[model samples]
Target: MTLGNRKKNAVKAATAAKVDALLVTHLPDVRYVSGFTGSNAALVLTGNRAVLFTDGRYTAQAKAEAAGTRVVIEKKPAVTAACEWIERAGIQRCGFDAAHTTVAALEAMRKAVTSKVRRSLFHPVGALVAALREVKDADEISRMRVAAALGCSLFDQMLSIIEPGMTEIAVAAELEHQARLAGAEGMSFDTIVASGERSALPHGHATTAKLPRQGFVTLDFGVILDGYCSDMTRTVHMGNALPGEHEAYDAVLEAQEAAVAVVAPGVTAGDVDEAARSVLRRAKLDRFFTHSTGHGVGLEIHEGPRLAAKQTQPLAEGMVITIEPGIYIPGRFGLRIEDMVLVTATGGEVLTPSPKAWIQL
Candidate 1:
């Protein structure tokens, strides 16, 4: 969709919510609507007009990038200027994202307007623009595909160089360096290189700990390309795996694949989670499978339509999400197998189709 269409859709949503205008201060939402990518920005949307507010630092950049909106460069803060503009435009009720707005921020926003309308001007709209962003357009899906492919290539390269004696941080550094060389804008998040017992930590960041000779090394990472993010996790063994180690890896793989199989249009996110959890439950490892099954991924690493127990959000076509299932046995070992799966009309398509089989480095 073009930037103008996106703004039009947002305005339609604001109208449905009984608001005259929407004050979008979230950076990603701002980018999605107006194509403005600067650090400071605020987009005000009405039925007939769209205006982007920013400081002088982004005067030229905002004007150039924000294609469908009128650019207003002001010396004051962007949000304050946007609120003031809304009042001047005679907007009675302006919607703002309650999820992203803070108490202090709301107070400041109200202070920007006159006392008569300050108390009731800004209405609390819950994730108005974020809901629109959950489903990927063709352009967004194309960019995400490239990002996922880069992550898969990086994983393939890491298999050749990872050894038992290498430090976890060193492995992360090499992976990041290669990503930069491969034209990645940055990493989606801090690279995770959890080894040995540290694998039990779901979000174990790269540390100085050395890789173990006979334990699992979990590499969970993502990359950003063309303003999109890709996330996948692969756990490999250093030397020989113990008797139960191989079995655990197999169980996690089965669970991850099972979840990926159920991803399709009209499927509930909870059903997908249950599909993975049922596999681990059959293996008697469900207790160790901490965290949700997965989450939606796109402009942000984590988005809406969470795949977890009791989540009722239905999967829609064009939504990209992750299917990651793991078992963390504290002090003993842990393993995770993840893939970026795109929801399609028929079923899920694995974006990161690198080797998920047992890899003993």
Candidate 2:
């Protein structure tokens, strides 16, 4: 959606929440509404006015990047400027994202205004713009598709370079270099290159550990492109895999695919999680499957509508999420198969449709 539409939606939400204005201090929220991708920014939204506040450092940048919004460059902190502006505009009940705002930050915001308005001026609004951002627009989906494609191509390149003796950090460095050459703004998160027993750690980042001659190498990474993020994980065997290892990989792949198949409009996020968990449960690997099945992805790597047990949020079209399932057997082996799936009207479409077939090198 256009920036104007986003601001309009935020205003409508603020109105519904019984607030006259919204003070957005979160950088991502500010970017979502005002199109300002600066490091320091605060966006104040009302029914009729949308103003972006930033420091003097972003004077020209804010004006050029923030479209269809009023840009106010101030010498003071952006949040302080935004709060003062709200008080001057006669806004009494301004909403702030309490989830993102800390106690000290709130105190500073309240201190920016007069004592008469400080006590009752700011209302707690939880993730107003972030909730709106959960559903990707056509433009956002297009950008995410490109990011996912770039991740898949990087994985393809890594397959040829991975060997038994390569250090995990070296592997990650090469992958990151390739991503930069391919035009990624940055990585979504620190690259994960868990080899052999290290694969048991779900978030094991790239270290100096060397790849084993015959064990699983889990590669979990993502790339940032055009202000969007893409996440996917694939585990490959270095040399030869035992029969049990092959079975475990098969089970995880099946579980990941099962979860991807259930993604569609009107489906509950819990149902999607169960679709994957049930597969692993049948394989007697449920205990090894840790973490949620997936989460909404867009401007941020992790968003709302999380796919996990007892989560009642329903999936909607235009939401992109990851379907990742794995079994990590500590001190033995582990493998994860993931795909960036876009929720569609009919079902789900895999954005990262690289080869998931068994790859032994």
| Root-mean-square deviation of every model | 0.7, 0.7
Model 2 CA deviation exceeding 4 Å by range: none
Count of backbone clashes for each model? 0, 0
The digit string of per-residue lDDT tens for model 2 on 1-361 reads 7899999999999999999999998898899999999999889999999999888888899999999999998888989999999999999899999999999999999899999998999999789899999889999999999999999999999999999899999999999999999999999999999999999998989999999999999999999999999999999998888769998998998999889888899999999999999999999999999899988888889998799998999999988999888888898988898899998889999999999988999
lDDT of 2 at 322: 90
Distance (Å) between predicted and true CA of 72, model 1?
0.4
Candidate 2 C-alpha error for residue 131, in Å: 0.6
- The model with the greatest lDDT is 1
What value of lDDT does candidate 2 attain over all alpha carbons? 0.93
TM for every model, in the order presented, reads 0.99, 0.99
lDDT of 2 at 42: 89
Clashing pairs in 1: none
